[model samples]
Target: MLSLILIGGSIFASCRKQIAVQSIPNMPVNYTIYDNSAQAIKLAKEGMLSITNVEVENTAIGYGGLLVVSRTITPSAEDLAYDLSCPYEVKQDVRVRPSKDNSFAVRCPVCGSVFNVAENGGAPIAGPAASSNSPRRMRQYRVIRQPDGIRIIN
Candidate 1:
């Protein structure tokens, strides 16, 4: 009976989800990028682009705009989209920029946190933010493929 109880407790512990150390207010994020648009064309060439949060044509640009990246050079590579806001700063104006030396990472100018944008979930890999008990990760949005282009939403 004791062994069973211990096993059950361990299972519960492992099931706990990791939570962000810092808190960021949720904001509306609904935007679409048409494949035929100039922005899409530019992204295809650059592989990365940052979009500022702005109101245009009834689309929500998200909390601090959006960071879109093409994971691979392949034409069919799926793009990943994340919020520009810095998790440690928690301010919409304070955002992370792509690392100059590494295309797969982003750095926060304010908190100095380096997030691995290329890996799973954009988790902080360096700086004070990652040393914390529960580090915060970049807020990501869902990108759904559309007939016209791609839709990003929270």
Candidate 2:
């Protein structure tokens, strides 16, 4: 009887789930948008990137409430990726704000959940975050460079 109880307890513990957010997979797609790298850096430095373009932002909201922004790094001009999804909940209403460390992150005003953008921008850092699930992963939009302009799509 004692051995059976121990075995059962171990099994239960082992079966516990891990809570983490996940994002859509990144695939090769074409996006026709402004390739102004300076604007991206400006937004990063400002600690906030608003969606002035309703069409673009709405498209993201339509597709799983997420959008990927691709920026071209200077000198190397390497591409950097980001998602517009709120890591706390699957809601398009949430907006990203800068963390105390000056990093781009999202804060769900409704739930007060903070998500860190530095680590892919989908993992909850503090407040009412899932403690059990897979490791939080954000969806990435594949960015392709074209001679005419930069293509960003997922």
Candidate 3:
């Protein structure tokens, strides 16, 4: 009789559903990393625009937010837009230096996940992230060209 009761209780508990909810930021992060138009133009000309590292707060959804600097890749230029988030583990360790190959790629310093910046920083040809259980892809931001500079937003 005790065995039967225990089995029923176990089954009931197993049937219960568990859900987790996370708090998300209401307002978009407005980063004016590029002070003016010249700076934006300079970045466009250079082909790569490196911005001052800013910490992003929201991290529960997928990957942590990032301080993305905005600049336009000319109308004729092939556009490559990527979020600062890392695809493998949702978020990457702070201070991971994105690769400088001009291929728009970023390498996770901690896990050595090489992301192809060309395709929203997706998993690249080789890296530890290649064998990860979660085959995640990087977030890509929409790029819009304004009269003054480029705008990257959600």
**Who wins the lDDT comparison?**
1
- For model 2, how many clashes? 9
Candidate 1, residue 124: Cα displacement in angstroms equals: 0.6
Task: Give the higher-lDDT candidate: 2 or 3.
Answer: 2
| Every candidate's CA RMSD | 3.8, 5.5, 9.2
Q: In candidate 2, list every pair of residues with a backbone clash.
A: 18-132, 18-133, 19-132, 19-133, 20-133, 21-136, 21-137, 23-139, 31-152
Per-model lDDT: 0.81, 0.49, 0.48
| Residue-by-residue lDDT tens digits, candidate 3, 39-122 | 456555665554434434441222344423223432335444454555554543432345765445567666676765544334
Q: Supply the global lDDT for candidate 3.
A: 0.48
* Candidate 2: C-alpha lDDT: 0.49
Per-residue lDDT of candidate 2, residues 74-94 (tens digit): 223334344554444555455
Give the TM-score comparing model 1 with the true structure, all chains together.
Answer: 0.81
In TM-score terms, candidate 2 sits at 0.55
**TM-score against truth, every candidate:** 0.81, 0.55, 0.53
lDDT (C-alpha) at residue 23 in model 1: 60
What's the lDDT for residue 103 in model 2? 48
Cα miss at 6, model 3 (Å)? Answer: 34
